[model samples]
Target: MATNQNFIGGFQVNRHLLIAGAALTGAGALIGLTGTVIVGAALASAGRGWVRQLDTPPSELATRKLHQARAASLAGLEAWRTGTDGSPN
Candidate 1:
């Protein structure tokens, strides 16, 4: 008489499914890590800008220097415009 040797209702577990699930989970974790790194870099850049803006003394000094430079340039331009030839006063 012939006899069956297979057990567990003759149902075999698919190895492909297990491998595919692991690969998908690893890919998702890598994507999540990459997204976190990108967000951290962006936040650092924005935080630097915020800190620079918050430093009132340095910002004021820079603004004063810029205004002085602009005024000097305007004065030089006026002097050149009123001169006989384009020679600087």
Candidate 2:
């Protein structure tokens, strides 16, 4: 099934339904039909998909790698400060 990668108000949605709703809304405007606009809005709203899981905790190796990255980042920052600003902390 096709799904939207972009978030709509912090939640994902059905891209197809959203596009259909937009088309319908544009058609409604052109034809001057309030019912069409309402239907379009309903379709667009029905497309919304609520977020369930944001992220999962890293595994052991992944956690180790994350720590390594953090250490490297700090070391690089310290080196830059010492060399450029002559400040060591």
Candidate 3:
């Protein structure tokens, strides 16, 4: 008589399937861990940059420039709405 069976530690199981499942599980875990590390590093770097920006005070010239730019944009919008900018309707 001939038989085909696999026994491991007194347990009859398919060894090939078990090994393949383990390899797949490990690969998934590795990819998940790598993604987590990359995201964590990116967040950490951004936090550092944010902290640095918070520690610095805005320059007077830069603030003035921002205000001027905002005023100019608002004026342009107003002129366009009233058709005072002289562009063809």
Candidate 4:
């Protein structure tokens, strides 16, 4: 869907987190370490949260508009990526 393509922000943060969590979770299970499992679960939860924030509708975090320069830069980058003239993207 076009919505999927439009709502983009996080590129790698969520993925590395998820991979680390899954690996840790499996290792913890093999080693019978409850604490390791807890940490891994926490990381996985954080990764999923990141996914929800990045991929959901309105695709923006609470602080997305906090910095004018950063926002403008991101808008510019998106405009270039989409091959536009940066018309209020």
lDDT of each: 0.81, 0.74, 0.81, 0.71
Error of 1 at 32 (Å): 0.6
The candidate, 2 or 3, that scores higher on TM-score is 3
Every model's TM-score:
0.48, 0.29, 0.50, 0.27
User: Best to worst by lDDT, what's the order?
Assistant: 1, 3, 2, 4
Residue 76 error, candidate 3, Å: 57
Please give the clash total of every predicted structure, in order: 0, 0, 0, 0
| Ten contiguous residues minimizing lDDT sum, candidate 3 | 1-10
Stretches of candidate 2 exceeding 4 Å from the true structure = 6-10, 33-89
Off by over 4 Å in 1: 1-12, 56-89
In model 2, the Cα lDDT at residue 27 comes to 89
Once fitted onto the true fold, the runs of candidate 4 whose alpha carbons sit more than 4 angstroms away are 1-32, 55-89
lDDT of 4 by residue, 1-89 (tens): 32222235643345556678999999978788877788999999998887777654343543565576688888989989989973674
Summed over model 1, clashes come to 0
| TM-score between candidate 1 and the true structure | 0.48
Q: Candidate 3 residues 20-87, lDDT tens each? A: 89999999999999999999999999987876677454566579889999999999999889879666
lDDT of 3 at 57: 46
Clashing pairs in 1: none
* Residue range 17-63, candidate 1, lDDT tens digits: 76789999999999999999999999999988987778576778899
Give me the runs in candidate 3 sitting further than 4 Å from their true place.
1-11, 56-89
